[model samples]
Target: MLDLTKLAQQMQGISQQLTLEATATRQRLDRAQLLMAQANERQADLVQMQELWRDRLNFTAAMPLESLDTRIEIAAPPAAHTVIATDGSQIAPSHHEIAYCYLINVGRIILHYGQSKLPLLDSLPEVFYRPEDLYVSRQWGIRTEEWMGYQRTALEAQILAELAQALTDEMEAPTLALTDGSLIYWFLEQLPAEARDRILAPILAAWDQLRAISVPLVGYISASRSGEALNFLRLQSCPYLAPDCMTHCSEVVDRAPCQVLDPLKDAALWAIRLEPGQRSPLWKSSARIQEFYGDHAIHFCYVNVGSEIARVEVPAWVAADEDMLQSALSLVLGQVQKGYGYPVALAEAHNQAVVRGGDRARFFALLEQQMIKAGLRNVGTSYKETRKRGSIA
Candidate 1:
């Protein structure tokens, strides 16, 4: 038989080693469990923070009604004189095609004029004229290249010159020229020195002449629906106010007292009270806040133009709720259609194809039919066909 005492001692040492190993492994497992629990806690905290942020934003976006006190009154239209509403539209590629469409109405007589640069692509150099009085097409040497900047400048100069000439040629003596937009044209800065001088010199001269003759030179922007101020108000869930009111509010918000307000705080306050189709006018006193606050305090006053009376000054960031995006877009589109007379009827034409069913001949036939319906006489259609060669026998 072996030595019992020696075997017992060896077994005890082995058991001790196994017990130490098991204790170490259990400690490691406990550490891992603690780390996992900490990670889960951090995740929950993050989620809670996000939820709090959203709630805060939503609350600040709620509309505030503190200063809306003015009563609503519809102003009568000003005494109608010879009103001429002129609008200019510019297209890209070759800026040569600058379209200046104007509506001149004196009493019952209405005159519409659209002057555009005739595109001389390839070898054709021509000027197409279509007016209420005369329809004339003449070949004029005008070349346009692919350079957008140079083309834009050249086209603006040409159009401005044409506009000045048209003003003198069409109107007898000095007459009032009422432009449909802002007095200063934004594109004026983009033109070259010579072109700029050429374009503006005559315009200023015309203005001087009009001033001398007591002819009023008025410009009306007609409350642009796409204005940034209006859009911001709409996004903030406050669209009922006039564009000018929103503009004033934006100005105030940028200043001292209002700027200090936490974005989320303001948004929460404004979002709750601001309703759809709500409108308010910011007062002159509020507009002069900079004078009162001395570059420190923020002040805004608004008179409710909407049926409901709620006025709130809020930060822009609070207004950027994701839920407001679609509503803002719809409001903008509606405003654009109502204010700008954008063609809602012809919206389907936006997707209409030039050719359909992969049949070129049929497309031409359909085009001719459309032309005929549009009162074009003696409409003709022609096309070139490609033929495939037969394989050699």
Candidate 2:
């Protein structure tokens, strides 16, 4: 039972906070105006800043390092194009359950844009119970959800890449492989090196497989709030004189160069520039994951998807190849138009992968039945769970 009265009281505070933030954001944008105009003038100093703080700063590069103003016109999808997408859902391990287990379900959709054929849809659900699957490290403490979630996400990409590779190998026409987030495995950076490698090795292998197949794989982040580009703009605000990056920005907050645009996101910055189906200039990622990727470093562009500006991520190989880039853009925009401002294949994959409340109840019931048949005592749930369900008989 939700406490609507309490929730309503909380809403007032949220509304007030939003209003204050909005005002601050506008002021920040105003301060950023001069720097935005003088971006070209300040571009030369960014490298020196990077060189100086190469070890100190955690921010990504401030702006486009090369090809600052190249906007390619929107191209139409090929007459015979195939759009493939994959998404995932997961059930975290519950201590109250009879078995200490977790599940990951990946759903994929392959839709032919021009052909009059039915779309191929399938879901692969796996239950993990092995000791290795259930292992939790001292670093994670009691939180295994993050570990399992990362694995599920990585698996989703691997699965999508594998499917894309197999289909691309047989297809004659242009095929676009789409996934629902950044292609770079950014989350693994916080983990210990060995742990990160253990998880990322297979994902990297799958990326290699996709590259070998020569398919255009794109990651679509809808309503992206990524401020990677804006971080570059922040560099423009650094007042430290060129060749002397000695003084850090933190010490001179008021004297810092471009604070006005601090509140704006990359999406907000590009919203005014890009038209529907058009993509903004490509920019390289400065994430730590970039080092691991090397030649396959992640690069991104902003696309106006009619509804909102979406950030699309691709490996360097895809970005460097004009044909592949154009194909990815056209296919993604076409999918968005067909999906009424969202990609239909991704939506379908998500729908297929979702684990509903009813499904969870049934899963627990089945597990209990199996336990009983095995001559085990009934595994009762915790008092908290029982209270939440209000005496389920």
Candidate 3:
């Protein structure tokens, strides 16, 4: 009986050890599965890159540029300058409702207009303006209204025509044009080449005139909050606001000190200036910083601008400092890249106003109403409620 009892105790100990080992082995298997998943994701990304390169190479090889004796002209920055900031705002109907976006572009030019020390010229034509309403179907799956195909093309043509008129009538000749987004919309791919050429030709002609007079063109895009770089920054515990803040990620890794404070109240705030530094892993190889916010944050250039790059950090408390103002302008540029493929307008109508918590429900309600008004079909609510009866007598 004593030997039997000792044998039972040893068996119990061996069983417990086996159970522990089984658990550990299961955990190792789970870890291996997770690693395999990650590797597969990386492999997929590599395949996508290869496909993109193939497409790009094919497109470039098929399109050959006609070369001419084109002389390259470089323009020097003005000793004393006035900066003109222009922006455009639009509210257009999507498939189901309307959407709003704005653009702001800024540039410095030799003060040509009046006696005022301010660099702003009152006579300068508005670079940013809103055009007439365009009724178009929302085929892009972004918003859900279906309009005729020609509607989008017509609206784009009107926008381009208005832009050309503004450039000719109000803008000074030989002045730099600073745009908040890409010079051309990527959606141009959907339009016929002849139509695209017709719309862009005038704009290019205006640009050439400015270039001939030694005026440089620059485009700036802000950081996007929803972008991969900013998302990574948020995950890494960097300070940033949501929704209203710009979203695109920058590839440059540089830091500059900036004072972010309320100047009117004499209070201090947290602000940092961005200085260009080494390339970051986050940036695409060809990316360049048009504006910098801090280490690992910058507004990147998506289009070529012939202007000299300058950066300045300012205290947030100072109500206005031109150099600092330019930094703030950089954020607008970033927003253009992240939000809409256009520059931000400088006017108050185009300003990115913050929505308060109290207004959240109201905003959505208005949006729903607008969709209804726009004739977008909707499905019934997906909710049901049940009430329990009180105790019966």
Candidate 4:
């Protein structure tokens, strides 16, 4: 067992160290602001720099669509609009489980405000026990876990598309469709070109549907650690007249002049400057994968949502159109206000998707019962798993 009592004396020192770090962080943000002010007029130079380094460098930097300080006023959300959201959970197939089975539960939520439409909330649970479901290529022993996350993302987006199409005649159109994380499909980048194409087909199709419907699909990331904005500031701070990180700063990674802002996140740049309900300028993502997005290219902006800074991403079409961007952001602000620092639809969806510990045990028990009913002799757990549940003193 671990005891906290032994470290009582060091607690104050830890607090003091944290305070010092906070002070240092504030100084770093101040430095970045100075760089932003100086770089505002050098937007052309910045863009040129990014294009020059496009394929050679593997860094995430924000590409501003306008002047660095440009911002849009968030209009009031429609008093009567619908918000739909999705979240997913999974029970991974395990060696210790009673069967080689896993579960995917997707939660869907739709809420209509300023209208009497009853909310639609449901969790769709799917069980995968078949050889086809358990493995992508069983001969190579590539289990589902190796690729389930991307599959779930595609599934969630596809469901959102279904919800949008299904509700068109039944109710007023959704003002926004939301999910709780990055929409970039960065996970697929790790796969081979052919594999990525096969896995990404569904997600792209879902995005195409949303694009056709023009219902702004948003990916809301609360307390984001992305350094796109910070990376931009880093480029501005690059000491070379013609900056080339490889040619100049490659040997001096730690001692580079731009490393001053390296410790800070992107949100810190807007935390103090942007008022609640205000947002940072839209910046197109530099991800290589977005090159393939075609109609669904990604752009993001940071919003000051009262309690915390949130990174909000939308498709290129929505981001470029002023009216759609305004509509989506205003509703996002409303959702944050209603939920108190988070989106209400997403919160409800998460509540539906989360699987409890008791649920896990009961799930396995049910699996065992069903296996016995089917006369399956292979439904057995390892001795180690049994010991984990009923440990000895």
lDDT leader: 4
Residue-level lDDT for 2 in candidate 2:
100
Instruction: Give the whole-model CA lDDT for all candidates, comma-separated.
Output: 0.30, 0.78, 0.30, 0.83
In model 2, where is the ten-residue run with the lowest total lDDT?
A: 240-249
| Residues 128-192 of candidate 4: C-alpha lDDT, one tens digit per residue | 78876777534444457866666677778888888887776765644688999998877666677
State how far residue 59 of model 1 sits from its true place (Å): 30
TM-score per candidate, chains pooled? 0.26, 0.89, 0.30, 0.94
Candidate 2 to native Cα RMSD, angstroms: 2.9
Best-to-worst ranking by lDDT:
4, 2, 1, 3
lDDT (tens digit, per residue) of candidate 3 on 225-306: 1121212111112232221122322322342111111011100000011122111111111112211211212222111121
By TM-score rank, best first, the candidates go: 4, 2, 3, 1
Q: Candidate 3: where are CA atoms >4 Å away?
A: 1-79, 91-175, 224-393
Q: Tens digit of lDDT per residue, candidate 1, span 192-270?
A: 5554454446545544444344334333222222121111122223232222233345445444222222222212222
Best by TM-score: 4
What TM-score does candidate 4 reach?
0.94
